[model samples]
Structures are given as structure tokens and as C-alpha cells.
Target: MMPDRSDLSAIAALLREVAGSIVMPRFGHIGPADLRTKSGPLDPVTVADEAAERALTEGLRALFPDVAVIGEESVAADPALLGAVAGPAPVFVIDPIDGTQNYAAGLPLFGLMIALVEGNQTIAGLIHDPLRDDTMLATRGAGAFLLRGAAARAEFLPLRVAAPAPLAQMIASVSWQYMAADEKSRVLARLDAIGQTPNLRCAAATYRAMASGHMHATVSRRTLPWDHAAGTLIVEEAGGHVRRPDGEAWRPADIDGGLIAAADRDTWHRLRDALYG
Candidate 1:
């Protein structure tokens, strides 16, 4: 069943609470860490990730008994298992720790991402910065908002893409994915036109930067549903566009590792034209 606007709001509140409980206990306590790699050397996961994911999974099941969930940890065990909840039916996509690297490094930029995919498209999203207890939320057709603290007032905000800015003055964010030699050279060449290329290691932070208009745009060569889901909507809700290099529309069920997001429509087109040519 499709959740109404009120339902999404309630879910966001629950998600925020879950993230706070699981993540706050270990904040600023960088002692006796328990971290491990997932796919490669730099792809790290910690106890906090698992604990937070478990909490989210359990809470969602309790709240929406009929809904399906696909979590980062579960997908890691059997990547093929993701198909079980990828589309059509109501599904909850989660990245318990969107910026695992930042979290491991003791940075407060890390966050929790939760997105509800209804039939292939993301209809609602909520991102929580557990360290700061800040929440960015959005529902399709409805506006987005930022909520601070437990009892803070919700600020209703509209997302509108800015007009085209000069490419030389634009700020672009890209990930250092393990690209092949040819891909690396091509990406660098594309970025050369922009004068200065900025790279941020964490997706959630990068998305936040772009949404807040500090960064003009952001693109990632490698991303899963959880990586882009919540942030993509937040950016779009904050007046941005999220798409692919070939001008292809992004679908939530896509796990083939391509993600592009920009602060405004024009910036997105500029980057797309530059990179694809």
C-alpha cells in the first residue's frame, strides 16, 4: 500500500529516532573500534553500521508489516537477493551509515539514509545526521524540510533549481571510484573545462553540500540505491536534478553503479554535455 503524506512524515520521525538511538551511543568515542572491509580495502563497515541497520530493519517491519526492506548489510551477503524487493511493491531502502568512511574517521558529516521506493521511483526520503541530529526530509509532490533537535520546529522549504552559472565558477563534486585508466583520463579531461574540480569522500555529505547550495553540483561513478536514494530526492527537493551522464533518468532499482546529481538544472546539463562529449 502506498503511504500517504502523513504516513511518510510519521515514518521519517521514526527513522530519525532509530538513527539517534543506535548512533548516538558511540559518538565521539573513537576508542576500541570494530571495523572491517566489505568489497575492497577502502570500503569499510563498523559495528555502528550493523547495529543501526538492524534497528532500522526491525523498526520498519514493525511499523509497516507488509513492506519489504533492502539493507546494505543484507545486500552484501547476497547481492542477488536485492531483486527480492527492488520494485513494484512498496519497499524501504536504507543506508544505515551513508558515509562509513567519514564515520570511521570521526567526522560529524556522516548520516543515515532512508528512502521509500514505490514501483521503481523513490517517493519519499529522509536523511538524518545523527551527530548533529539534523533531518532532511522530502515526499513526492510535497515540499522538503529540515528539522533540528527532537522538539525543533520544522521549516518548510521549496526546492528550485538555480539558473545556469558560469562553468569556470561552478563547484563540482566527484568520487574517487576505482575507475579504469581510460575512464580516469576521460573524467579528468571532462573536469578540465570546469577550472577547479572538488572531490568529497562521502556521498551524504556531498549531497548535503549541493542541496545547501555550497556546492554547485556532484557526480559519482559508483553508487548503490542506498547511496543516492535519499540524497537524490533531497537535492531535487532543494531545487536540483539527479540523473546519469547519458541523460538517462535514474531509477531506484538500478544497481549498475552510475549516479549523477546537481544543485540546479543548468549545472546538471553543463556537466552532462561536458562529460559525455
Candidate 2:
């Protein structure tokens, strides 16, 4: 069943609860033993990531007992868990902490991301900032909003992407870390055509900045569902455009082929042409 506004609020409260009880307490206290590498030295997972994932998994299951939960750390331990996104049942894709590298270093630039996907479509998405105690959320047909404060006394502000601009006048976050050397070289050579291109090393932050009109676009080489699913929906709901550089819609199960998110379809096309054309 599609979650209504009340259900969304409940989920937001759960996110806040997990952030307060499990995530924030362990933030700056992470030690050498509390951290370990995942895919490589650049990809690290900490105690907070694992603990928060467990708590969120349990909490989400309690809310919807039969729904599937696919978390980043959980999938790392068991690759088969990612198949649930393509299954018939709705699945919650969780990135307990999106910016693990920054979070492990005690930088307050990380976020908690969760997306509810039914088949190939994302129904609801949420990106929560543990340090700020606020959430950016979107339900399929409903518009995106910034949620703050307690559930009983929460505030919701509509979110919109920035107006489209010329390629040389836009600010974007371009992530080419996982790209092929040839493709990376081509992208790097073309970046001079844009106004500013910075990599936040955090998809949640990148998406948040774009949705809040602080950024114009973002190009990513990795398409992990937990990383892009929530942010994709949030950006699209906020009047932005998210798709593959080839101009295809982003599916929950798509793990490669690169993705581009921009303020509008025109901006997306322009950016794609400028960078990949």
C-alpha cells in the first residue's frame, strides 16, 4: 500500500529516532577499531553505519512487517539481498549513512537515506540529516518538502530546484570516481565548459543541494540503489530531472550506466551534451 501523509510522518519520526539514539551518539566517537574498509580504502564502513542499519531495519520491519528491507551494509554482507528491489513486494532501500568517508572522519556532511520501491518504481523517498534533525522527503505524486521539528509540531516547506541556466553559468557536483579512465578523461576535459563542478563525496548532500536550489546539477558514475533511489525521487519531486546520461529513466535496480540530475530537462540535456556528447 502507498504510504499516506501520516505514514510518511511516522517514518520520518522513526528516522529521527534512529538518528538520535543510534547514529548521533556514535558520530565523532568512532575509533580505529570501529571502522573498516569495504570495497577499498576509499569505501569505509563504521560501527555507526552497521548499528544504524540494524536499528532502521528493525524499525521499518515493525512498521510494515512483510515489506522487504535492503540496506547498504546488509547488502554488502549478502549481495543477494539487493534482488528484493526487483521483487513484487515493496522494498525499503536504506543507506543508513550515505557519506561514510566523511562521517568516519567526524565531518557533519553525511545523511540517512531511505526509499520505498515497488517493482521498479520508487513510491516514497527520504533523506534525513542526523546533525540537523531535519528531513527532505517526497511521496510519488505529492510534492517534495523539508520537514523539521517534532512530529506533533513539525514544519513543512516546499522544495524547488533552481532555475535552469547556461552550461557555463551552472554549479554542479560531478562524481567520476568509478568511471573508466577513458571516460573520466573525456569528462574532465569537458568540465571546463561549466561554471563550477565540485564533488561533495556524498550523494545525499549533492541531491539536497540541488533540490534546495543551491546547486544546478550532479553527475554520478555509480548508481547504487541505496545511494540514488531516495535522492532521485526527492529531486524529481522537487521539479528536477534525473536520468541516465543516455536519457533513460533511472530504475531502482540499475547499478551502472551513470546518472545525471539537473534542474530541468533542458538543463539535463545541455549538461549531457556538454559533458558526454
Candidate 3:
């Protein structure tokens, strides 16, 4: 069954509490000992990430019985749990801090993400901006919108992607760090037509920019569930488009072959063919 307004509200409240308690308090005050490098030098996880994920996981499990909780930090400790997201149970995907590097660097661009994936589809997803205390939320079939302010007194702002524009006018976010040496040069060589290609280094914020129309598209070579699931649903629900470079629909469990998102289907295809074709 689809989540009703009350259910969605509960999820939003939980996000707010988690941010207020675990995230904001330790944002710029992370001790060096509490931080460690992950896949690369640029990737770092702090105490806040672990605390927030643990808080959310426990709270969510109590709030909704029987759903598997898959957190980025948890998966790091046990690689086998990643397979559970593709299993039969509903999975609550969590990214306590989507941009830990930026957060650790004292930048306020990081955000929180949650998505409920059942089977191969994302049903309800949300991206919460702790710095601004606002959240972008969407459910399949229902529209997407922004909730700004305290949970009880938040304002609802409808979100929509920018209308299709000429390719030369479109802006995009592409992280060069995720690309290989040969493919990186090949892809960068073909981006002359875009207005600008900025790398936010934060998927949560990158997708927010796309869903709210500030950016026309984003190219992601890495597709972790916590990174893409919530953002993908929000963008698509806001009338944007998403697909793999190979033109396959982006399922919840599909992580290979990278992902492309654009203001519309035509723009997505044009950009994909030019860069990946």
C-alpha cells in the first residue's frame, strides 16, 4: 500500500529529529579521531554519519516493523547486506549525510536521504537539507514538493524541473573523480555544448538542484542505493527524467553502467548519446 500523508509526515518528523539531534550538533565539530577515509581521500565518514544512521535505523525499525534497514555505513561493515536490498522485504535505504566531505569541511551543502524500495522500485523517498531545515519528498504516482521549516509548521513548495531548453543553455553536474582515465578524457571532450558543468560533490544537493530546476542534468558513474534512490524518485516525480547510459530504466537494484538525469527525456537522450554513445 502507498504511504498516506500521515505516514509521510511521520517519516519527515523522524528526519527532522535525526538532523536536530545527531547531524547539526556535530556538523563542523567532528574530531579527527572520529573521521576516517573511505574509498578515496575525498571520501570521509565521521561520527555524525554513524550516530545518525544508527538513530534512524533503530527509530525506523520501531516505526515500521519488518522492513530491512540498509545504511551506507552499515553496508561498509558488512558487504553482504547489500544483497538484501534486492530481496523480498521492503528496504529503508539511508544516507545519514550525503555529502560528508563537504560537511566535514564546514560547508553547509550536505543533506540527508531516505528511500523505501520494494522489489525494484522506489516507493517513497525524501532528501532533507539540515542546514535549511527543509525536505524534498515524493511517492510514486504522487507529486513531489518541498517542506520547509519545522515539521509541524512547514511550508509546502511544489517542485518542478526546468522546461526543455536548447542544449547549449543547459547546466550539468558531473564528477570527474568517478571516471576512469580513458573514459574521462573522452567524456570531457564532448561537453563543449553545455553552458556549464559544475561538480557539487554531493549527490543530495546535485539532485536537489536538478529537481528544483537550478541544474539541467547530472552524470553519475557510481550508483549506490543511498546516493541515487531518493534523489531519482524526487527528480522523476518533479517531471524530470532518468535512465542509464545504455537507455535502461533505472531500477532500485540496478547499479551498473552509471546514470543520467535531465530536465526532460529529449535532453537526457541527446546528452547521453553525445557523451556515452
Candidate 4:
């Protein structure tokens, strides 16, 4: 089931509130003891990530008592929690700080991402940027929109993907670090030859950039639900396309394989063949 309009607004507000009370206050004030190495030294997790996730999880549970919540920190503590996404219960997936590395270094590129998953499909999605005080939201069958500011006078901008552009004129953002080391060079060499590729190190911001019509496409091998669920719905609602490089629909339950999204199918196919073939 999709999140109601009022629920989306409330969740968006909840994200901002959590960030204000739990995330922003501890941004540049973290100490060595508050940080830890996760997957590797380059992958870091902070107290803020945990705090934000905890607060959001609890807040969401209170709002929708029957829904299950799967957060990044929660998954780290128990990988089994991912099973909830495919279960009968509606699951809310959360990524508290998508660009933890950027956030750790005092950059404001990080944001919070949440998606409502019913079985295998994403029914509703939201990506919130506390730094900018705006949110990109989409519910199934409903158009995506950008809500600017949190005040009563907030502005709503209807979102649409940019007009289709040729491969040579495309501006794509790719996350190369997620690719296999041996194949990264060849793939990137070809990507650089065709378009201007930039890595913002944050999926939420990258998706926002695409849905906002500032980018043509994005390629990524990391396909975690919390990371891509909200993004897929937002871009699709904006009239863009998303699928695996081999041409399969993206579902919240699948966690492997690469994804390529573009403003049009023509661009998606061209970019997919050029980069993956």
C-alpha cells in the first residue's frame, strides 16, 4: 500500500525533526571515540547515524504501529531484519545518513532516505535534505514533487526529468568504488570518453539531481534497498526510467546486480550498452 499524502508530509517532517535534534547538533562535534570503522577503514559509521536511525525508527513505528521498519544501523546489528521487506507486513526502509563519509568530513551532501515497501515493490518514497530543508517525495501513481522549506509557506515544484539528450551530451553520475576493482578501469575509461561523469558519494543527492533534471542518468553497482528504493520511485514518477543493465525491473527485495537510470529509454539503452557492453 502507498503512503497517504498526509503520511508522506508527516514523515518528511519527522525526518527534518530527527535531523535537527539528533544529526545536525553532532555534525562537526564528533570525537574519535564516537566514530568506528565498519566495512573498512574508508567506510565509517558515527553516533549521529545511529541516533538518527533510532529516532526515525521509533517515530515511524508510533505513526504506523503495524508496519515494520528496517534501518541501516538496525540491519548492521541484525542482517535478518532484511527479511521483513519480503514479508507480509509493510516495511519501511531507512538510510539515515546516505553519505556518511561526506557527513563525517563535515560536508552537507548527506541526506536521509526512506521508502515504503509492500512485498517486493516500493509504494511510496522520500528523500530529505535537512541542510537544504527540502524533500523529494513520490507515491505510486502520483507524480513526484520537491517541497522547499518547512514553513507554512513552503513551495512545491513539480518534478520532471530532463529532455532526452544524445550519449555525447549526457551528464551521468556513477559510483565506481562499488564496481569490481579489475573491471572498474575499463568501464570508467569508456564512461569518461562519452559523457561528463561525477561521483557525489551520496545516492540521495545524486537521485535528487537526476529527478530535478540537472542530470541525465546514474550508474551504480550497489543496489541496497534503503539506498535505491526511494530514488527509483522518485525518478520514475518524474517520468524517467530505471532497470538493471541487462533490462529488468528493480525491486526492493533484490540486492545484487547493477542499475542504470535515465531520462528516457533511448538514453538508458544507449548508456547501458556503452558502459556495460
Candidate 5:
């Protein structure tokens, strides 16, 4: 059964309102607020991120009791919880804050990304940019759209990628970490060899650029399902393709592998080959 657009719109609006209230109050507060380093010093999580995730989880669970939820902050506390939910049940995966670094730095480049995942497929998804008051949403066949206002009036916009361009002429979005030093050097060398400029904007904005035709492609060695699931559907719906560099299909279950996404089939294939070469 298809999810209702009105319900999704309502959820988006609710998320925007809640997140805006939480984030807006801390815009320029400089003092440290009980930061914790998860994987490393570079991977920091703040009280605001956790508070926001809690708000979303509670609201979703209250609003839709049947659906399961897997949030990044919750999984961070209990990594084993994800395996327990690995079944056919529809799970709502969420990254309460995609660009944690940006958020910590008080930059407005972060967002709240959520997706409804059943098995290996994403059914419905929304990425809400509270700073810009823009919500990018998509359901399986309902098409993608941008909702920007209090009334939540739908502005239908077909997502389309530009024609396949050469890797040299493309602006690639690649992350700096997640790969070994040698592997990172090799990837950077190849990117430089192709004359492609590498930009490491947070995943939300980076994928948003890919969907909006502002960037050609994005490759990541770190596969956080919560981060990729929502954006993956958005990019594919926008006429792009995402897969492992070896040409294998990607799923939310495999969150420890690599991904290669492009504006089109030609670009996807070419980038995959270049990355593996």
C-alpha cells in the first residue's frame, strides 16, 4: 500500500517545526555542550543532535505505532539493536543530523534525513533542511517534490540529472575519511588525474546537489544506511543511479561498503570504472 502524501507532508512539517525550534536556539552558542567522540575526534555528537533524534523517534512512534524506527543516535548507544530489526518489517531509518560537524560548527549545512525501508528497498523518504525551510520528499511512485512554507503546498518538480559528462569535467562529491590512508591517497590521485574537483559537503547537501543537477556524482567508502537510504531514493528518482563500484546493487543492510552514484547510467558506469582502475 502506498503511503499518503498528506500524511508525509504532515510529518515533514512536524519535523521541520520541531527541528527548527531545537536548532535555532543554539545558532551561535560557542561553549562546548557535552560533546562525545564516537569513532574519533572528527566524529562528534552533541546534546542537540540527541535531543532532536529523541523528539523525532517519540513523535513517529506515537503517530505510527506499527512502523519500526532505527535512528543513528540510538544505534550509536546500542550497535547490536540494528541486527535485531533486520527483517521484512518496514523500518524507518533516520539520521537525526546528517552533517554533525557542520551543526557543531554552527553552519546551516545539516539536515534531518529519514526513510522508510522494507527489506532492502526504500519506500518513502524525506530530507528536511530546517535552515532553508526546504523539504525534499519522495514516495515510490508519487514522484519527488520540494515543500517550502507553513502551508506545505506542494510544488511538483521532476528531478533530472544532466547529460552524462566525462569524469574530468565533473564535479565529484567525495568524503575525506572512511578509507585507509593509502587508499585515500590513491582515490585522491585518481580524482586529480581526471581533473575532477572533490568536494566533501555533508551527505545531505552533497546528494541534494546531485539531485538538483548542481553536482555530477558522489562516491563514499563509508556507507551509513541512515545517511544513504533517503538520499539514494531521491537521487534515483531524480534520474541518477547508485551502486557499488563493482556494479552491484546497494542496500541499506550493507552499511559498511562503498557506493558510487552518478547523474546518469553513462556517468555512473564511467565513474565506477575510474574508481576501480
Candidate 6:
């Protein structure tokens, strides 16, 4: 069954606790010894990421003993853990720190993301900003909301995507880091059609911006489940549009083929055509 408001609160509380204890404490204090390269120099995994993931995993298991937990750090050690997302049972996907590069550099732009996936579809999602102590959450069919302050005294504000705008007036976050050389060049050339294309290096923040109407869209060439699953659901719930570059719905099991999220379907189509057509 999908989580209700009470369950969402519990999960949010867990994220807050872990962020306060494990993530924020090490935000600007990371040392060379506390960090290590993952796929490459551009991909980093810090002590905070590992520690927070452990706490999150433990907390989630405690909350739902039967649900499988697939954390970025844990999956790095055991790639098979990712298979849980495609399984028949429910699974929780966690990204302890979404922008390790920024966090390691003392920039407070990272976030903690978690998504509950069942039957290969995301049923709920949460993105918590540790510094702001606010969370953007969404459960399928219930709409999206932003919760602030402690759980007991939390205030939930409804979230919505920006009103539709012309392609030339839209601002977007475009990630070209993993794109093929030829494809990257082609997309970059077409980006001039948009008003602005900034790279925040944090998917959580980008999704938040799009959901809250601060930005119009985002285009990502890499679609890792931990990175996009939660954010995509949040945006869609907030009345945005999301799909792979080919115009098919994005699923938790999709690892690549690019993804586009926009304020609406018309914007998505325009952006897709500008970038690929």
C-alpha cells in the first residue's frame, strides 16, 4: 500500500534526523581523507554520504521491515542491490547526498532524496534540504507539497509548476556531463533557444526549482534511479510533465536514454524538439 500522511511524516522526520546528525555536521568540514572518488574524479563519495545512507537505511528498515532499501553508497559496494527496484515487492531508493561535489566544496546546495517504488513505479518521493530544514514531498495522485518546521508543527504549502511560457522565455537546468561528445555539442548548440540553461550540479535542487515555479524545465542525459525517481515524481505531482527523450514515460528501472521535465507537455515537446529535432 502507498504511504499516507502519517507515514510521510515519519519518513520526513527520519530524513531530518539523519540530515541534522550525519549530513549537516560534515557539510563544510569535509577533509581529503573523508572523501573518495567513485566512477571518476568528477563523481565523489564522502564520509557523510556513507554514514547518512547507513542511518537512512537502518531507519527505513525499522519503519518497514519487509521493504528493501537500495542506497547509492550500498549499491556501490553491491551492485545487485539495485535489482530490488525492479522486483515485485516494494523498495526504497536513497541518495544520501545528491551533490557531493558541492557539499565537499563547502557549498550548501546538496539534498537528501528518497523514493518508494513498487512494481517498478514510484508511488512516493521526498527531497529534503538539510540547511533549510524543508522537504518537498509527493505521493501519486495526492499532489505535491512542501513541509517546513518540525513534524508536529510543520506547515505544508502546496506546490505547482510554473505557468506555461514560450520556449524562448523558459529557464532550465541542463546536465550535459555524461552526454556523448557529438550529442552534447548538438544539444548545447540548441540550448540558445531557451532563456537560460544553468547547471546547479544538484538534481534535487533542480527538481525543487521546477516544482515551485522558480524554473521552467530540466534536461538530463543520465537518468539514474536514485537521482531522478523522486524528483520526477515530485514534479509530475506538482503539475509538470516528465518523459524520456523519446516521449515515453520514465520508469525507475531506466538508467539512461535521457530525461526531460517541463512545466507542461507543450513545453516538453518544444524543448525536446529544440534539443533533438
Going through the candidates in the order shown, the clash numbers are 2, 0, 0, 0, 0, 0
Residue lDDT tens for model 1, 1-277: 5466566556667767877677767656645457888888778888888988888888888888998887899889778857754557878988988878777778777888888888778888888777666777777766566765453455444444345578887778766465557877887777767745776677777777776667878777765788887788878887788887667888777666566787666778888777656
Write the residue-wise lDDT of candidate 3 on 188-239 in tens digits: 9988877789988899999999899899999988788999999999999999
Cα distance off (Å), candidate 1, residue 119: 1.8
TM-scores for all candidates: the values are 0.90, 0.98, 0.96, 0.96, 0.93, 0.98
Stretch of 10 with least lDDT, candidate 6: 147-156
lDDT of 4 by residue, 113-181 (tens): 999999788999999987887899999899999977765766668999999888788999878777787
The parts of candidate 3 lying over 4 Å away from their true place are none
User: What C-alpha lDDT do the candidate models reach, one value each?
Assistant: 0.75, 0.92, 0.87, 0.88, 0.78, 0.93
Model 1: ten consecutive residues of lowest lDDT: 151-160
lDDT of 2: 0.92
Instruction: Give the worst 10-residue stretch by lDDT in candidate 4.
Output: 147-156
Instruction: Give the candidates in order of lDDT, highest first.
Output: 6, 2, 4, 3, 5, 1
Local lDDT at 50 for model 5:
84
In lDDT terms, how accurate is model 1?
A: 0.75
Residue-wise C-alpha lDDT for candidate 5, range 1-277, written one tens digit per residue: 2568776877787678767877667655624755677989878888877888888888788877898887998998899867633577888887888888887887778888988888777888788887788788788766677766766455555676666777678887877478878878878777764546655457888878777888888888878788888888888888888898777888887776788888888888777667667
The digit string of per-residue lDDT tens for model 2 on 101-195 reads 99989888999999999988899999999888999999998999999888679988999999999988999999999999999999999999999
Residue 195, candidate 6: how far off, in angstroms? 0.4
Q: Report the lDDT tens digits of candidate 6 across residue range 1-277.
A: 5999889989999999999999998888999999999889988999999999999999999999988899888988999888888888999999999999999999989999999999889999999999899999999999999989885799889999999888888998999989999999999899889998889999999999999999999999888899999999999999999999999998998887889999999999999999999
What local lDDT score does residue 205 receive in model 6, on the 0 to 100 scale?
A: 94
Q: Is candidate 4 or candidate 6 better by lDDT?
A: 6
TM-score, structure 4 vs. true:
0.96
Ranking the candidates on TM-score from highest down gives 6, 2, 3, 4, 5, 1
